[model samples]
Target: MAGLITILIDGITYASWLFIVALGLTLVFGVLKILNIAHGSFYALGAYAAASFVGWAASMKWAPGLSLVAMLLAAVAVAALVAPLTERGLLRFFYGRDEVLLVLVTYAMFLIMEDVTKLVWGANPYYVSEPYSLFGNVDVGKQSYVGYDFALVGLAAVVGSAVWWGLNRTRIGKIVTVVIHSSEIAASMGINVSRVYMGAFAVGIFLAAIGGAFTAPMISVQPGVSVGVIIVSFAVVIIGGLGSIEGAAVGALIVGLARSIAVHTAPVAELFSIYIVMAIVLMFRPEGLFQRIQARKI
Candidate 1:
C-alpha cells in the first residue's frame, strides 16, 4: 500500500509537468500545423529566465512566496518577447512551404537558440531552490510530499481546464478551430489567419515556458535540459496524438505512471520504459490514441 501510494503521488507530479510541456507542443501542432523543434529551446530559455528572475528577487529581499510569481512572470516575458519574434521574424516566411522543410527550419532554429543560450548564460548551472519549500509539506499516508508538488497538480488541472474551455467554449476558440480545420478557408472567410497563428504560437510558447519555470526549482537549470524535455514532450504529444489536448493529458499520465513503475520495480528499465510504451501505442494506433485519420486532399 505504501508503495502504491508513493507511485501514485510521484506519477501524478511527473505527469503534471509533462502535460504542461506536451500541451504546448500539441497546441502548436493543432493550430499552426508546425512541428516546432525549437519548442524545447523555449523551455530551456524559460528555465534560465526564471532562475535569473527568481535569483534577483531573492537578492532584493522580496518575499519567498513571491518567487512563484517571479517564475510565472518569467514565462510570460519569454512568451511575449521570443514567441512573436520567432513567429514574425522567421516562421511566418516559411508558411505554406513543405511540412518537412518547415520542420528542418525549426531544427535549425533550435541549433541557433542553443548557441544563443550558451553565449548569453555561459555554461554554468543555476540552482533556484528557494521556491521549492515555500508551501511547506504535506503528509500523505506514509509519504510526506511537498505542498508545491500538490500545488503543481492543481496548476496543471487549472491550465488544462482553461485551455480546454477556451478552445471549445469561447468565440475566439471557435475562430481558432476554424483556422485549424482550414486556414485557407478561414482567410477566405475574412478571418485574419496570420494573427490567429501568432496568437496560438504565443500561447504555445507560454505553456512551454511555464513548464520550464515551474520545473526550475526542482532541477539544476543548465544546458542540455531542453533536449530531454523536447524528447519526452514529443513522446507525450505523439502518444496522445498530435493536436489533441485530452490526448496530451492522457498520454502524460500513461508515460508518467509507466516510468514511475519502472523506477520502483526495475531501475534498469527507467529510461527505456517511456519509449517502450510509445512504441507499443504507435504499433497499434499510428495516428495516436486521440487523433483521428486526417484525410489527404488531392
Candidate 2:
C-alpha cells in the first residue's frame, strides 16, 4: 500500500509536468486550429533560459529561494519575446493555409530554433536544482524524499484549476472557446482573430515555457530534450481530444499513471503502454471521449 501511494504521488508529479507542456499545445490547436510543432522549442527555450538565469542568480549574492523565482521570470520573458515574433512574423503567414503546411512551418521553425540554441548555449546540458533543494525534505514511513516533489503536485492542481476557470468561467475564456468553435464566425461577430491568435499562441508558449522552467530544477537541460517533450506532449494532446482542456488534464493523468504502472508491472512495454491506451481510446471514440462538436456534411 505504501509503495502504491508513492507510485501514485510520482504519477501526479509526472502528470503535472505533462500538463505544463501539453496545455499550450492543446490551446494553440484549440484556438488557432494549428498544431505548433514549435511548442516543444518554446519549452526547450524556457528550460535553457531558466537554467542560465538560475545559474547566474545562484552565483550572485541573492536571497534564498530566489532562483526558482528567476526561473519563472526567465520562462515568461522567453515566451513574451519568442511567442509574439513567432506567431506574428512566422506563423501568421500560414494562418489560413492547410494544417500540414502550418505544421511544416512550425517544424521548420523548431529546427531553426535548435540551431539557434546550439549557437547561443552550445551543446552541453545545463541544470539547476535550487527549487528542489529549497523545498527541503519530508519523511514518510521509512523513506525521506524532497518536499518539492509533493509541493509540485499541489502546484499542478492549482494551475490546472486556474486554467479551467480561465477557460470556462471567465469572459476571455468564453471568447476563446467561441473562437475555437469557429474562428470565421467569431471574426464575423466582431472579434479580432489576429489579436486572439497572437494572445492564444503567446499564452500557449507561456504555459510550455513555464513547464520547462518548473522542470529545470529536476531535469537536465539537454539540447535534444525538446524532441522527447514534443513527442510526449503530442500524445497528451491527441489523447486528451485535440482542443479539450479537461481532456488534456485527464490524458496527462492517464499517461502518467500508465507509465508508472508499466515501470513496475511491465518494464519491457513501458514505451508502448501509452500508445496502446491511445489506440484503444481512438478505436472507440474517434472524435475523442469528451468532444461534443459534430462535423457537418460537406
Candidate 3:
C-alpha cells in the first residue's frame, strides 16, 4: 500500500510538470498550427530567468516566501519580452511558408537560443534550490514528500481548468476557436486573425515559461536543458494528440505514471518507457488519443 501511494504521488507530481509544458506545446499547435521547436527554448529561458531573479532576491535577503512570486514574475517577464519578439519578429514572416520550412526555422531558433543562454548566463549550473524547501514537507507513511510537489499538482489542475474555460467559455476563446477552425474565414468575418494568432502564441509562451520557472528550484538551471524537455514534450503531445488540451493532460498523466512504474520496477527501462508507450499508442491511433480526423478539402 505504501509503495502504491509513493507511485501515485511521484506520478502525479511528475505529470503536473509535464502537463504544464505540454499544455503550451499543444496550445501553440492548436491555434497557430505550427509545431514550435523553440517552445523548449522558452522553457530554458524561463528557468534561467527565474534562477537569476530568485538568486538576486536571495542575495538581497528578501523574504524566502517571496521567491515563488519572483519565479512567477520571471515567467511573465519572459513571456512579455520574448514572445512578441519571436512571434512577430521571426515567426510572422514564415507564416505562409511550408510547414516543414517553419519547423526548420524554429529548430534553428532553438539552436540559436541555446547559445544565447550560455552567452548570457555562462555555462555554469545555477543553483536556486532554496525556494524548493520553503513550502515545508508532507509525511505519508514511512515516506516524506515535498509540499511543493503537491503544490505543483494543484497548480496543474488550476492551469488545466483555466485553459479549458478560457478556450470554451470566454469570448476571446470563441474568436480564437473560430480562427482555429479556419483563419481565413475568421479574417473574412472581420476578426483580426493575426492578432488572435499573436495572443495565442503569447499565452503558449507564458505557460512554457512558467513550467520552467517553477521547475528551476527543483533542478540545476543550465544550458542544454531545453533539449530533453522538448523531446519529452513532443512525446506527451504525440501520445495525447496534438492540439488537444484534454489530450495534453491525459498524455502527461500517462507518461508520468508509466515512467514511475518503470523506475520502481525495472530501472533499466526508465529512459525508454515513455517512447515505448508512444510507439504502442501510435501503432493503434496515429492521430493520437484525442485528435479527430479532419476532412481535408481536396
- The TM-score between candidate 2 and the true structure equals 0.95
Q: Please list all clashing residue pairs in model 1, or write none if there are none.
A: none
Each candidate's lDDT (Cα)? Answer: 0.94, 0.85, 0.93
Residue-level lDDT tens digits of model 3 in 208-287: 99999999988888888999999999999999999999999999999999889999999899879999999999999999
User: In candidate 2, which residue pairs get closer than 3 Å at backbone N, Cα or C atoms, i.e. clash?
Assistant: none
Ranking by lDDT: 1, 3, 2
Best candidate, lDDT-wise? Answer: 1
Candidate 1 wrong stretches, greater than 4 Å:
none
Candidate 3: regions farther than 4 A off = none
The whole-model C-alpha lDDT of candidate 2 against the native structure comes to 0.85
Error of 3 at 259 (Å): 0.9
Instruction: Write the number of the candidate with greater lDDT, choosing between 1 and 3.
Output: 1
TM-score of each candidate? 0.98, 0.95, 0.98
TM-score of 1: 0.98
Across residues 33-151, which tens digit of lDDT does each residue of candidate 1 receive?
A: 89999999999999999999999999999999999999999999999999889999999999989999999999999999999989999999999999999889999877889998988
